[model samples]
Target: MKALITGVAGFIGYHLAQRLLVEGVEVYGIDNLNDYYQVTLKKDRLAQLQDKPGFTFQFLDLCDRQGITELFQSHRFEYVVNLAAQAGVRYSIENPHAYVDSNIVGFVNLLEACRHSSIQHLVYASSSSVYGVNPKIPFAVGDNVDHPISLYAASKKANELMAYTYSHLFHLPTTGLRFFTVYGPWGRPDMAYFKFTQAIEAGTPIDVYNFGDMKRDFTYIDDIIEGIVRLLPLAPQLEDVNSLEQSTPQAPYKLYNIGNNNPVALVRFIEVIEAELGKKAQKNFLPMQPGDVPITYADVDDLMRDVGFQPTTSIEEGVARFVQWYRSYYG
Candidate 1:
């Protein structure tokens, strides 16, 4: 069994590759190694896999059409997971072009590649940000996500639509995982969890956006990986879609929400961080930023029904684990 993981150096992508390699599956990975964040951290992730068996990596970008085409043609990948994107709501407000290039155009390139190949399933990462300003609680796959306040969210929503098109037209079996707030060791530094830890340790003030009233369905990295692994071999089947049953077409496409069913308030999340660090955080309360949602709760009923699993990690445990890694890595 061979799999291809784009953004192989990313936090999620790296962890997934490690899991698959341990399963004795041949893994081919790729990443642009863009310096959107710390390139050193990305390289450290790759270093952990570079010496492992059944693993091969290439420096490639999804936006590179010819490169992706060549890669698909060269090797037969049973599964493909794309986790690369210009990831950040606030960053999108600053740099919208990056989102379009990587998330939109890059994704189209990948979809085109998968359509022409004999891939079993193409699982891509979507975001909870898609449920922009939605009044709905515990956002479900069936809920309407027609409106988006950020380019990052719109790009992810576009990915779901594009994948469905390929599944409908070309019979490309695809799955889109709408992830909630994912955090853990080796996570992105730009994330609130990581930033809060950084500032608290540095004795600086952490900005509390939305007056620290926002709630998020914080999911652990391991939990997210488990959901993906369970779904990889369980691609959507056309037969599963009855003519009068589902509202959509008879396509081999599935979408699932990978999240802890519980939503954690920002203040509570901070308390966990503070408890783990054993340090008090100086906070600066602030109003909601543009393109920011006050809450993100995921409806994981469908995910549980399909995969028999949902995220079970608590913020306390997850935060402690992250702090342990942060201390060890930084030391």
Candidate 2:
């Protein structure tokens, strides 16, 4: 079976592609290699997969309609995983058009391609940010996410709506996974965990936002990939639509939260990083930033009930693993 993965040079995309390659699956991966973070890091990721057997890398953008259409026509991909997007809450505030072009327009292009290609299952990444400002302790798929504080979250919500429309009108099977704060080796440099690691290693100060009162359901990359791999073969059947009471129509569409159910405190997360790195962080406490939530807790009951798995990597272990890779990669 051949699978097409967008954003193959990204954190999650790289990990997912690696897993699929090990499973003896033919994989076609694409990435624009934008300078959203560092071009070198993305290129390094591609280098790892470039020579692998049954793996092909294409430097392409999701917004390229004609190019994407040609790709779909040429490769009869059984599965399509859309992981490409302008990924950062704060970055979205400054560049809203980037989110529109990548997350909105690019997504519509994917849906249209899937509609005509007869792809079996289309899995895409959503975000925990979509639960914006909800008073709910553990965010669930059935909860109301109409109020999004950031344009990034709004674009993800738009993706879900667009996928549902395609599923309803064209009978395509689409699944959206709402990922919590994902971190590990080869993670985005812009993320707090990576930044904290860098600052502490450099004997500099790390920014502790919200006065270190924030909580996040930080999920490990391996655990996230495990959940996605399990759901790949299991598409949502139209008859199963009635089982879920959310905004799900009588279509082959589903949404699940793939996250570590435990929410770790911001201070505690930093503590883990420090312990792993064998150094103390000089923290500069600051008030909450705009579009930043106080906490993110994912309710993975639906994911567990269906996929029989949830992210279980502890912050302590995950952070230690990241530290080992960070030192080796940067050394």
Candidate 3:
């Protein structure tokens, strides 16, 4: 079967597409090559998959209506995975328009294409940030995510709503995965882990937000991908609209929290990274900034119940693997 994966040049997209391709699945990938961080890194990722059999790529933007429709009409994709978006909470505060353009308008275009193409299933990326300012300890899929602190989070929430609409109106099989603090090799430099490694290696001070009091469910990339791979075949079956708490009530729609299910303190996470790198980091603790959350924990019972998903990688091992790849990639 053929799969069309958006944001194939992105960290998660690259890894997911690689996994599917290795499994002998035909994959068509696309990205606009936007200079969000460094286009070179994105290009480097795309280069790795260009020569693989059953792998093809296009330089296209989701906001381009005609482009998206034309591509969908031409390719017979059995599955559609939407991973492209304007990511980062802090950056969202600066360029809010980018989020609306890519995450909102661009997403609508993708949904339109899927609806017209009669795609079998659509799996899209959501963010834990959607549970903004919730006092809840571990964010659950059934929780109320009406308050989003950042535009990026709001756009993601909007995507979930839009997906449900398509599913209800067209019976489209749609699944949304709320990923939390995903990190590993070939990760984005804009992420905290990548930035921390860069600063620590250069003897620079690493910024610790919320005075190192924050907590996060730092999930490894492999674990997140495993959850997605398992859920790929578990399509929803549409039923009646009784309550909003039910995720997959036979309505051909579902949502799951793909996370470590263990929140690690920021200071502790940094300690693990330092231990792995065999170096001490110069820390610059700072108060929480706007559009930032104090903690993010995930209750992934639904994921486990449906797919037997469990995160087994510890921070120490995950950090060590990342450090090894960072040294070789940048040294």
Candidate 1: where are CA atoms >4 Å away? Answer: 239-247
Report the Cα RMSD per candidate.
Answer: 1.5, 1.2, 1.7
Task: Give the deviation of candidate 2 from the true structure as CA RMSD.
Answer: 1.2
**What are the per-residue Cα lDDT tens digits for candidate 1 across 234-328?**
98886443212366678888888899999999999999999999899999999999999999999999888888999999898899999999999
| Residue lDDT tens for model 3, 1-331 | 9999999999999999999998888999999989999999899999999999999999999999999999998988889999999999999999999999999999999999999886788999999999998998788888899999999999999999999998888888899999999999999999999999999999999999989989999999999888888888777777633227655444678888888989999899999888888889999999998999999999988877877777878898889999999998888
Candidate 2 Cα outliers beyond 4 Å, as residue runs: 242-248
On lDDT, the stronger of 2 and 3 is: 2
- Residue 140, model 1: lDDT of 84
Model 1 quality (TM-score):
0.98
Q: How many clashes does the backbone of model 1 have?
A: 0
TM-score (C-alpha, index-matched) for candidate 3: 0.97
Higher-TM-score candidate of 2 and 3: 2
Q: List the residue pairs that clash in candidate 3.
A: 237-250, 237-251, 237-252, 238-250, 238-251, 238-252, 239-250, 239-251
Backbone Cα, N, C clashes tallied per candidate? 0, 0, 8
